[model samples]
Target: MDATADASTRKPAAFIGRRLLSLLYDLLPVVALWFLAAVPFVLLDVAVSGDVRHNIGPFSLLQWLLWLACWIVTGLYATVSWRRGGQTLGMRPWRLRVVADDGGAPTHGALWRRYAVGMVSLLVAGVGFWWAWIDRERLTWHDRASGTRIVRMSKRN
Candidate 1:
């Protein structure tokens, strides 16, 4: 395949504004997943301790584990969606699709890297995402680091 030809036909890279909109849309599912994942952990704790604790103690191992579980579950949701169709439920509404920088389907590793860096980007108050404004290509840290990019697909007629 001619890389240049494929590049020429690919959709334009999604801008930060569009990306943010899709993220906001995605938050709904992610929050639901977190709630679903937390249920089992909380239930098990109640079974083992014979106490109906409403919340995990802060800085405790259970709390840490819960957080880790939530993170992994969220990652699975994102990476699998991107791998299957390049669009998560959130991206679909916005016509945004994640693709390899070379205009092909992104690899599993690349998708995970993208997810990981995206997590870091969030932890740092979205500095990595904001970097896109200054980037020559308007790419985020995750986009550049993972060799992936989100593109805005044109509407179908």
Candidate 2:
């Protein structure tokens, strides 16, 4: 078999450690995005409220909207990166790539599903990620829901 074929056929690596590391790396850019997204919301609040507010109020409408915007912006970053290259900036360092369970690039719909499920998984204190430890195939909740998997790539010769 060709080198590419051999690499593609390998089972996904045990991923929890690498996935967490990648998330830590990805956090930097996502935080930057959150700050950028908050800019307009902050400005609008300042204009309307006429107060120099350092932060949005707890449970307020504007605060919720800002949270939603950050979620969307983060999703855009993740989905676009996955769609274009199957690897986010974070995943690159770990040699991880997201792919369909069938070993092909996932469709846009699947990618979005993956993101949404992943968000829920994170919100639940990453029970989904922990589940991979016991899952027979080492699949996370998002992986099962979205029909996708993250595979670690072999080193290039």
Candidate 3:
């Protein structure tokens, strides 16, 4: 068990602004991975033809494939981070940690669920994250649905 796992009783749910900021920070790595994910498509395109650009149109196969790749990469990054340490690179600097209902590191299944639900929340204009402000415990929709919560780390004396 990680030391931060025992924080529910001592630490509070993270503020929405903090969560948003951390997400913004996390996007840097995500975008980098996205670019990496595009490499194969570019390589294949170049090998088959002369151009290496992927046209992102409504009916573009390359676009769909790239989207899938990006989703898988994002899920891997989040799930691994959540299951291994309960924090991502962004969450680390912000002192945010994700824990299960029992305040332990989330299970793999829970982490995946959280990632999927989080995507849904984001797709819906972040209504789920906003739900935290009104939720009595300040848990987001994904957190509640996935049986997990993100908490602010307490200061260590």
lDDT of 3 by residue, 102-133 (tens): 76777888889999999999999999999999
- Candidate closer to the true structure by lDDT (higher is better), 1 or 3: 1
Clash pairs, model 2 backbone: none
- Tens digits of lDDT, candidate 1, 1-157: 8978876776667899989999999999999999999998899788878889556779789989999999999999999999999999999988999999878899999999999999999999999999999986789999998999998888991
> Looking at model 1, which ten-residue stretch has the lowest summed lDDT?
4-13
Cα RMSD of all models vs. native, in order, equals 2.1, 3.8, 4.3
Query: Scored by Cα lDDT, where does model 2 land?
Result: 0.89
Per-residue lDDT tens digits for candidate 2, residues 46-88, read: 8888888556788899999998999999999999999999999
Model with the higher lDDT, candidate 2 or 3: 2
Clashing pairs in 3: none
The CA lDDT at 107 in model 3 is 84
Judged by TM-score relative to the true structure, which candidate is superior, 1 or 3? 1
Deviating ranges (above 4 Å) for candidate 3: 1-10, 52-58
Which candidate achieves the best TM-score against the true structure? Answer: 1
Q: Candidate 2, residue 110: CA error in Å?
A: 0.6
Identify the superior model by lDDT, candidate 1 or candidate 2.
1
